[model samples]
Structures are given as C-alpha cells and as structure tokens.
Target: MKTVKQGDSGEEIAILNNALTQAGYSVKEGMTFTPALRETVVAFQQQRGLEPDGIVGYHTWEALLLGGESEATELADEDFSRGALLLDCETAALRAVQEVESGSRHGFVAPGKPTILFEGHIFWAQLKKRGIDPVQYAAQNGDILYPQWEKGHYRGGLKEYDRLEKARAIDREAADASASWGMFQVMGFNFAACGEKSVASFVAAMQQSARSQLKLFVRFIHQGGMLFALQRKEWATFARLYNGPRYAENRYDVKLAKAYAKYAR
Candidate 1:
C-alpha cells in the first residue's frame, strides 16, 4: 500500500493539523506553513517527547502518523516495538500533562496533572485513539461548551456556571452517544463493541475498533438512505436522525459530518 505524504491534500493537512492541535498547538484554517508554524510543530514534537529538532523526521513522523491507540499499546509491550518507534514513559507522561494543562485553559478538566506516569501516558494514548478532531469539530460548531470537571463540583462558581451553560448548549445540539473518550478520546461505543471495558483493555481492542469504525462508517455511507439524511447540510434534519428523528433538533449538531469528512479521506 502507498503511504500518505505531507502537503498531499486537505485531508492530509487536516490529519497533520489535528495531530498538531492534539499535541497542543494552534493552527488556523487555510494557514500555510511558515517559520512560526514550523516552530510550533517542533514545540509540539518536543512536548510529545519526540526529539526537539525542528524537522518532522522519523520519530516525529511516527508520532504524527501513528494512530493513538496503536502507539499506546505498541509502547506498552516493548520499549521500541517497530523500526524507529520508541516510547519513553517519562516523556509520554510529560506530554500528557502539557495537553491536560492546555485543555484546562479552554475550561476542560484534566484527569490529573500531566507527568511521566502510567496513568497520564495511558490517558494520552486513549485520547489519540478516539480519532475525533477536536479543532475542526470546535471550529464548525463552537467550543465544546462542556464542563471539564465532573458533575457536582462547583467550587469555581461563575466560571463553573458559564461552563455548565455552554455544555448544556452543546448537549442540546450533539449526540448523546459519541464514539470518543478520555484525553486521547477513543470512541466509547466503538471501544465497547470491540470488547474494550477499560483503558487497559484498549491495547487489545484498539486496532479492531479502528478497523471496525471505518467499516461501519463505510457501510453507513453505502446504505445511502438514513445515512444520507443524517449527512445533510441542514443541522435540524441531521441532528434529528443523529440520535432520533424526533428527539428535538436542539440536542444535536450536524457539523460533525463535515469534521469527520476531513479525516475520513
């Protein structure tokens, strides 16, 4: 099979963009490469525990190219599983911590402090596996508008209130059963179907979920009737079928299709 190349297409760019964003860098739409972007990419690499060199070489490429679930388990078994694939427990944890802290700024909660620890590494790996592009999704819709902290913890008062309201708005407009979870955010429904009951189980089920979701999505496309209605540009109809045809239009958004489209290619 042929491998994807950099500067290939919008889809490729979207992948890189999503990876960079997940690694804690900001990239605006239609923004081409610049010294600043390169610097940011390098910073992202360093944070991800890849070499700090300002070039997207092997390690950086693997981090960018390898799917989250794949990398996590690969490292779990061996220090360097495949050729040029190396995992440093300390670096991975630090990267996860950085991501959690950055996400917190946007009012999302981190499971814990980002550090070189098994929990943090596992968390980060899960997020990558979820495969939802947070940036593109956020752009088409708006900020996630959800609480980072679990329910019933309102020590922050106004800040918490605002976050709750935003989250309510998002809940009003999105599906209740998303296929994503954790910091790496692997899709929960997909994960469960693939026999994953815990993050620890993800190592065994990761590839299966990835392959299955892709097939499921393709099958949905092939069905071409209900799927067509769901993929429509109109948010109301799309949201309706997203969960149920009459579940109220305010509870789901249709923009996810667009975001997914960018990566599905």
Candidate 2:
C-alpha cells in the first residue's frame, strides 16, 4: 500500500528498481529512484494503462506486485526456505508444482514481458456466458485456447500479449478473463478462485513477485478442494484438476511426481 516516486531514496527504491529490472527494463535497483528509474516507471505505467506520471503509487504498487518480477532471489524450489512456507502443505509438494508450472529458476520472467497463455475455449465459454456471440470471433482467430501445446511446448509470451490486445478490443472484461497468466498460468476468469475480486486485479497480481503468485495458487487449491492432493502427493488428481482432463496427454502427473521426488530428497 506504500507509494514511491522520483527522488525517493531508501530500501523501497532498491526494491522497486529490482522489480523494474526483472520486468525487463534496463533500470538498476538502487536506493534512489533516479532518472533511470523514473523512465522505467513511466514506460511501465503507459504499458499497463496507467498515467505516465513516473510515479509509483498504490495502484502501481499492486500492478508491480502482480507483475512478472520479484524481489526474492530465484533459486531452486527444492530449497525448503525459498517461499514454500507460504503453502499450508509440505514445502516440497508446492515446490514440485512450482518446478513444473513455471520452471522460472533464474528470474520471475524472461526480463521483459510477462509470459502468458490465452485459452480460447475458456474465452469462448466466458463470452458465451456474458451474452457475447463467439462465432465471429472464432472465424477471426482459430483455436484461441492454443490446443496444440504439448510437453514442454507452449504458445505464450508476446504472442499472448497480441491475443489479449485483440480480445480487449472486442470485449475488455472477457478478454482479460480469457488469458492464463504468469509463471503459474492462472486464467483471468479464475480471479476469484485465486482470491481476487476482479480480472484486472488478478492480472495486476500476476505482475507481482513469485511469492504473490504462490499465494494465489494456494488460494486456488483451497477453493477447488485440491489441497488434499498436494498434501497426499496425489499427482494424478492434482494434475487433472489443475491442467484439465487431458492432463495425461502432457504427462503433467508424471512430471509432478518426478519433481516432487526430486524435492522430497
């Protein structure tokens, strides 16, 4: 809830600087919100639909927290001390999930835009429920769900940014809800499931640190009644519920098992 702006100097400045760097800006994390930091803030504000005032306020703070950067050192999830304590279940279990879901070891994101995967089917359903016809949309964009993803492959990153832009043009609310975001790939429609009130708020949370993502993941698990899966190491149940019925096609269950085993040590 704290606000930071230009000429600000202290630990918060360094933290903001680090988040900016992780978000792919060439700003240095320092004690002062120097000219370089101001530039980065302005660019981010413009990209995120905020006024380009170069001021880091409450709203921007929320966006940054939910964005693709982190103040935590990205380390092996197997390291028990690394943020896994936030999970009510065994740290290893959550770590295993993190390993498979994101694989973001060195940084929260690739030092640029947050990686995202848009689910066309989910979008289609959301639009239908919202009383918006989807046929015309399908004619324009085939398979928005990106049905072909398999194994380590995916359709995301800037490709998804473009997809979302188009979706926003048609229907902003539905478009935001359609895309799965962050290292966790949480769908925007599942915002409430992730403990957020609105899709926009959820997207902002995704822009924050990994710890925030994990918090949402935990909330999601609890809401979906899948906490037991993590507790018992029920990878099949967890994978199917988390990744959908076709979880076996991607062997997500098996990957979870392997990852859990590695972290269980």
Candidate 3:
C-alpha cells in the first residue's frame, strides 16, 4: 500500500483509523487523515517500538493489526520476564544480549524464518565430522565451505538462507548445525543444549516464534552453565561464552553492557 500520512483520505484511512481504535489509540471519525490521527499514530508507533515517523506504513499497519498478540517475529515483555526468571537474571540482561546478538530487537528476517548466519568454517568442520570431504565441495562452493573463519563473508538478511540451502544440499544435519539462529544467535550445533533432540527440531522452534527462541536461549544458557555469569552481569564473561573469545574484537561485552543499561533504565 502507498504511504498514508496527514491529508490523505480513502477506504485505507478508514481501515487505519479502525485498526488504531481497536489497538486502543484514539482516532477521530471518518476517512480523512488529520493531525490528531498523526499524533495518535506516532504515539502508537513509539509504544510498539516502531519508527515513530507519524506515517502509517507497512510496519505501522502490521503493528496496529497485530494488536500485541501473535507477532511471530517479535517478543512480548512476558517472554523476557519468563526467560530472565529461568536464568536467574534480570530481564534487562536478556534484552541486552538479544539486541547485541540479533543486531536489533527482531529475531526473524521474514515470516516463519528466523534470522540466520551460515558459518562456512563451521560447515567445513561439520562436513569433516560427518566424514564428507569438504575439499570436494570447496572447489565448487568456496563461499559456503572454507577451512577457517574470516570476516566480511556474511550475505546478511534473506540472502543468508541461500548460502544455507547450498550447504544443506551437502548434508542437511551439518548445514543446520553450521548456522546461528534467532534472537540469541544460538548455534544450531548446540541444539541439544537448547533442549532439542535434533538440529531440525531446533530450526523448527527457531522459526516458530520469539517465545520459542527465548525458550531455547534459556535452555542453552542454563545447560551450558552461562546463566551465573549473566545473572552477575559479568559482561566480559557472558560475552566470551556467548560470542566466542573474539568478543573483544567487536566489543560485544561493551555493547551488551550498554544495551543492558538502556533497558535497565
């Protein structure tokens, strides 16, 4: 749909007004967009963690329609609370890690698909573990199979799934295990620690909703013995365990600390 802002008028405006009203935002009658409606929209956007531009767009419409339930890609406040309770940490810690790991508040790049980063180095190891020579595939698909981790390889966004599909053709289980999935960026190889019987199950859960992702994160942290570090707000220790020893290179610890402070208020 085209952008709807102040002065626009039509069936769409009527629908937007109705949705805003349903979402508990005050809206005036009729189909014309007015300054009052714009203010209400901006307030709604801010409360929903959306870009508060006072323009009704795809994301704003989606938020208004969803009305705080069944947002598969987003997390509710209660999800964080339950996860924090499980980890014996403040909800702020969980929020901090989530923001740092996913690079934003969202866990999914698209509906039914959680954000993912396919690791070529991990794929090499996974193939080797499964006794399939990565060398055979390396010559043809160097981007998806490499002997060591390097920077600047990520395709980012939906394109990462294309890389994952290539790796999956070689070995489904190994491909699933090579990527980090969802808000927590939990490596799929840690599926067992995340309380999944198989990598496929882990991937399925990751795609389901943010709540499922949080559940997996809680399990992964608790089972991997990282919960205590998180509870104590040991940014360095938590970042090292969660993001690897190279966490300092990207300043994940500092980022986590900052994010935590922002959420903790």
Q: Give the top-scoring candidate (TM-score).
A: 3
Strongest candidate by lDDT? 3
**RMSD to truth, every model:** 18.4, 11.1, 14.0
Error of 3 at 189 (Å): 0.1
Task: Give all candidates' CA lDDT scores.
Answer: 0.35, 0.69, 0.84
Compared with the true structure, the alpha-carbon lDDT of candidate 2 equals 0.69
Off by over 4 Å in 3: 1-71
Q: Where does candidate 2 stray beyond 4 Å?
A: 1-83, 105-112, 143-154
User: Which has the better lDDT: candidate 1, or candidate 3?
Assistant: 3
lDDT of 2 by residue, 1-265 (tens): 2477888898778767766776677876569878878888999999889888988874465456444444553444433332342233677787787778767643244543455776667777778878988886777666453234432323455666776777777788888897776666677888998879998888777666555666566568767777778778999999988888898987999999999889789
TM-scores for all candidates: the values are: 0.24, 0.64, 0.72
